[model samples]
Target: MEGTRRTTLVLLLLACLLFLSLLATANSQLRTDFYKDTCPNVESLVRSAVANKFQQTFATASGTLRLFFHDCFVRGCDASVLLFSPSGKAEKDHPDDLSLAGDAFDTVIKAKAAVDSDPNCRNKVSCADILALATRDVVALSGGPSYAVELGRRDGRISTIAGVQHSLPHPDFSLDKLNTMFTSHGLTQTDMVALSGAHTIGFSHCKAFSKRIYNFSPENPIDPTLDRSYAFQLRTMCPINVDPNIAVGMDPTSPRTFDNAYFKNLRQSKGLFISDQILFNDARSRATVDLFASNNAAFNEAFVAAITKLGRVGVKTGNEGEIRRNCAAIN
Candidate 1:
């Protein structure tokens, strides 16, 4: 009888140890209110700063959103994309990132300044956190869901031009390529489709999608998959060998709004980038695209969940990284 009791006690102890281990593993490195005490007004300050920028130019919404995507996808939500290397070789210097709007960087910098203006919060906040908050504000201000963001990420000290190529998905990425790239970061196919919905509020350069409209191939000129009228409109906006710098809204109907219009555009063969259009063309992801196109509420919910997951990618907690005094330079 005593031996039986001893065995039961051992099993109980093992179960407790297992529970504790699982609990620790499940504990996120970040918390929604991490700055509750450190910088009580951090969220409000960022929101105000972002609002001010939006008043000047609605483009700030797209710019900030793109900046967040670039920052998170490369080097895991750290502000490495913001680093300005003196050698003219940095992550942001890469051709893929050349289209990142200056207003986005400016918005983040302005928010950082607002946080620092508070005596107690001066130099106490992480630029990564500021970027995240500003991104959330940009979406909210643009009439999208205002989801709570988890904080406590530290700014990475390293930013290499070479990293950008491997990290960011190109404008011409097919569904398979996008799956591979996003899956590397622990995101699933659903996450990839939902995140792509961010195109609802951004613009693409003429060069980025020129192939879809012109000289797709010798056999198939002007990508037969594109709608006829839509193709004609794009050709008018972006002439062959035209200045690559000319830009057009990704969602021509509602370029500045954050809604399911992007998915709707995809359904109509009006997606600006090949990467965006392929979500609807690919059988593996087409159902998701269709669902989002039909339901704005569903799209918003999925996007918020996916972006929240994105915010946690390879975060640096504890002492792994520093809080940069200047977002563009290492502290």
Candidate 2:
């Protein structure tokens, strides 16, 4: 009986190593053509669904974009953020993620349904891949650059409320803090700045940035770095004791477009988040922000590269994870 126990332990160790090796190999081989044969119309199916959602509400673009970022950062693009828990303890239930709009989850679910409606594609695609595709579609539909997304990701089974606490960047992070977090995921400072450009199309609730306008400091009522006029504007829009759920545009200049205007907003101290303003306030990252603000093409190129790299984080592939039948529940 002791020998049998020892053999079982050995088999478990071997299985773990094999799984790691397969993951490494599969992660490197995530290509755009991963489902060409299995689901030739996968991209189109996802695009159509995302487009329909986008037409219904422009929030669909920002919500889905933010959703993809949240999902990837927490569990490495495994769609773990989408998992629902009966105990009310999944990643989405975490305080940081609680703000994630339902529109984003609906976008992915809609796309998943569209994909599965096709007999050849039913159960053939992973929620992770569908999310990645839907994210790209939303960005393009909102007038951002269109890029090919790497696929072949499988849905992760683990989704714990505790897993999300330290995984995401906060609204008030400094440039140094931002760099430290993004760097851990193999993203450069430029990548961090570029990815942040997504704010051009998103909105942030008053709770996320009210500190800057009302009580930024004991000495100064408003954040010194904020444009005085913009601070007043924000104050008027988000008064004291305003509903925390009441939101404002993340990019004041071009609230609904995906463009370099976010960087431009940073230059004028109109960045809605302290983390956004720091890109220009700190000299080290100021050049990149200035460049992106001046050249839309450069921002688009860097954003695509950065987000493509972001998608590769902590990916589960090559049989390591399953193609979830429903994104909200682990199978």
Candidate 3:
């Protein structure tokens, strides 16, 4: 009889342990109030919308979608960014910055891909969810941190072109200017430099900075620190008379690989944009850039950490935002 009692006690304990395990798993999968119950396939919808808008533009649908998420989450994941105009201005004549069209589209697509890849994602994640997710993925892909992303954001009903122009920082801004712009968006100088690592993979047109390259104006000329050989190459593409959109990606070695090459190049003044050069010049950001450039393990870890934080900034939680049925059209 004592043996029988002992066996029963063991069985009871095992049952209790199993129940606790299951409960923990259930909690891990619980959907927060911020996220709307949605499906994973919405990424496809956003990709289609973006590709349809810019089929063969300088930017890829994938890259644009990534930018959209980054911008929205830097403060709050607000679709106000998608509402900009041609000159990077928001809510004006163009109603949407066509320059941002490619990047914006790409951001949404990648964000969805990241969330779908996560096994923990069970609820129908919306486009807004994708936006935050993509920001985390791209930054990590660029050798930055990968931080946690809070879900549950709603899309904006209205979009304006001027809004894009007004919001996006100028490509030629000094490190100080960039700090102001990023800080205004609730990001730090470290984030500005780290996130700007996006430039490592993407490219801009010659027309975008032709005024600085050819014009004798020092105030707007390309940063003096750029490699002379590289500068000459850029000039060849953007001649004085005919300035066209040319691809000058940040990573000259392997534009596709998201690594610390950007920081390595910056040390040599190979950074393509003035903003890119400024990061290395500043005391606060220089060390971080160098650390990432030298230590691959450290860079990867820090990149993930910063990106995760970037994804969750200014997010709308607990019923503040909605889940869009279709990411392209306003609901």
Candidate 4:
């Protein structure tokens, strides 16, 4: 009996020691000391890149979403979208919102510049590296439950503006249409609104959404019951001018801030973009949008979760892809 008891005690001790070892391994793996690791600050890199690119454009929604649209649509965030001409990987030129003028690489340049500024980025994070990582991180955080993203993605050296129209979701799409657009890219309707929640950050041009205001044609009908005050406000900036190049932010109340104002704007019928307003019109997503508007904490949490899911779409992990040295050039 004494020998049996001794063996049991020994086994328990070994189990405890093994558990402790596993805990320590996980703790070390989870450590995020930027000072020690050569890895650049992903959050900072993403924020900075987003800020830099969207200084002039995309004020209400996050530059992160814009980057996602750019990355995922063409080649699954392969950084080929960042490449200008001359590189082998050319994107088919597609029409985007008239406000963006179908420009490419604006977001990529900002991301690359941000990473380049970091001293720790040397030999660790490159423009291409940050592009891949930031794109993945933003998409993941904007969708479902947030997950940690893997680093080390290679960049490509080609960009074609062709076929962008097919890649981007149309502003005129209904909720079901929107769902199809997202699911086609491995996302859901929940992901659609959650990603759209990024509208809390940047701006949009009047030209992009003016049709919803003055032009009440059958193809583009404005909600007749929209708030008069908000309608007046939009008209002041976006006149009947044929060339509405003037960019007015979607969330005029809080253009630069990241918050639930976009949702609030939607409730007020002041959502600048047609796509934005459609959230409120849809029965399935209307309550969710209202919930987010009234409850910011809930919105923030959901937004982060959604973006994390968006990041994982078709990622090239574990030798599936190479890490490019430069974001603008091909590997």
Candidate 5:
């Protein structure tokens, strides 16, 4: 009888250990209320900071959104994109990120400051979490659906220009290239289409899309796929010798609002970037684009889902990274 009791006790101990292991794994992942106890006001503080910036300029919405995208694509959503290396070799210093607006970085800095204002929250919130919340706020403030952002992501310490160039999908990426890039991050083609909807609220520099408007090829001076009138407007806005710094809205119609119009523009061959228009050009993604163009609700739902998945990419947690004292520099 004593021998039987010893065996039963060992079994019970093993079961308890297994349960604790599972619990730890689950807790290590992101959660909706990770900061509820540590920084209860994190969400409100981020929202107010983003709102103040948005009130200053509507461009803040697109800027912050773009910042989040760049941050995630390079090294996950670790806020490494905000880091400033002494050698000027950080992710944001990459050629592709040169176009990332200053307003976006400023918005994050402001949001971080606001969060740290609370004594209980000072340096307690991770820049990564602040960025996620700011991104959600930007979308909601710009007439898009607001989704709950999962928290508990720690800040990454590494940011390299080479990583940005290798990881980010460029404006000139083909549909296949875009798919491959997104797929590497565990995002599906449908998610790529939905996330592309973010183009509805942003602007592009002439240098980024001028080839589409003029001298696309030796045989076809202009891209034949581009709409005639739309091409003409782009040509005017981005003349062959025009200053590269000049910018044009990605969505000419209601560019300030975040909506499904980007997909609609893709259907009409009015997409501003080759990457944006290629969704409709490819057979695999075209149907998804059409569906989103026709249904705003569906597009918004997919976008929320995709962005949430994006926030989970390469997350740092459970002693994996630090909560930096300053977002732009590592402690």
Candidate 6:
């Protein structure tokens, strides 16, 4: 067993090195000022539009934030997730992608329009860049820390339903599975914990976590890791045969704010999913969860770093990809 453990560690280390190399290459091509000459006002345009959408519906903040994550995780922040196909054959048509907030797509489309409306910025900014900027804007608007977003990503032309399989983490994943997925993206354990903090502003449909409350196992029925009170509360809101589409805040408290409350919730066993509660239940990640739960500043700093690295994954800069005139369709 000890020898197997050593082998796993060695393999994980090698994978981390390989992913780090890819991230280094991608980050080299991305810069905060890539749009300076072509579209100096791109940030402001996206921020204003995102703020308006946030005002119209608080869903905008969580939706857009989730959209950024889904896009990046699936196709490396190229905005391929934004593509639409009337025949329902695109990535957006995938079952996993369908749970994404519809408002998020509208948020990007509107922000793209706002950016192009500027005569000087017309069709000059990539939808990928606009999505990046809008993501930061939503976090800030939702009371999260504001951070710099590196730009210059070009829109990807391919977005197929087949691309989503095994590309993103599932709600039922354990700590080891979460770490493996995140480490493959060149993220550390700290980065995975911090990025998970985005749940601070998001909602999860009942179906995503129903098993924890309803039928975790024949023996327990309810997950023993879940707080009894919280489990009952969840059951009340999502009884058997309830519409799976019915949603609940991921962070029951301060769901609209982008804050460290997510960590705190996990500490209380109020985490909405097995993957979430696992951070506290598993000794390997419990300390990080404790620290983030106790220190908001630490959480914010780590979150910024993790998200910045996330933006660098699989990027296409320079002449590698086209600046899409329509985010839903490749140019």
In terms of lDDT, the best-performing candidate is 2
TM-score against native, each model: 0.91, 0.93, 0.67, 0.70, 0.91, 0.93
Candidates' C-alpha lDDT: 0.89, 0.93, 0.57, 0.60, 0.90, 0.91
lDDT of 2 at 15: 100
lDDT of 5 by residue, 182-296 (tens): 9887789999889989999998889888888788999987788889899998888888888878989999888999999998888899988889888998888899999999999
lDDT score for residue 218 of model 6: 96
- Those runs of model 1 whose alpha carbons end farther than 4 Å from true positions after fitting are 1-27
Which stretches in model 2 have alpha-carbon errors above 4 Å? 1-24
Give stretches of model 3 more than 4 Å off.
1-62, 73-75, 80-96, 101-124, 135-148, 216-223
Clashing pairs in 5: none
Candidate 6, 36-146: lDDT as tens digits: 898888889899999899999999989988899889888788999999888898988999899999899999999999998999999899999999999999999988989
Ranking by lDDT: 2, 6, 5, 1, 4, 3
Model 3 has a clash total of 56
As for TM-score, the candidate ahead, 2 or 3, is 2
| lDDT tens digits by residue: candidate 4, 211-283 | 7678767754554646667777778887888454576666768766667888998887877666788898778
The candidate with the higher TM-score, 3 or 6, is 6
Which digits, one per residue and each the tens of the lDDT, describe model 2 over residues 1-331? 9999999999999998997686568668799999999999999999999999999999899999999999988978999999999999999999999899889999999999999999999999999999999999999998999999999999999999999989999999999999999988879999999999999998999989989999999998999999999999999999998988898889887887888999998999998889999999999999999999999999999999999999998898887889999989988
In model 3, the worst 10-residue window by lDDT is 88-97
| Candidate 3 TM-score, true structure as reference | 0.67
Give the higher-TM-score candidate: 1 or 3. Answer: 1
| Candidate 6, residue 29: lDDT | 85
Cα lDDT tens digits for candidate 1, 225-304: 78878888989998897887788888878888899999998888888888888999999899999999999999999999
Query: After TM-score superposition, what is the CA distance of residue 217 in candidate 1 from its true location, in Å?
Result: 1.3
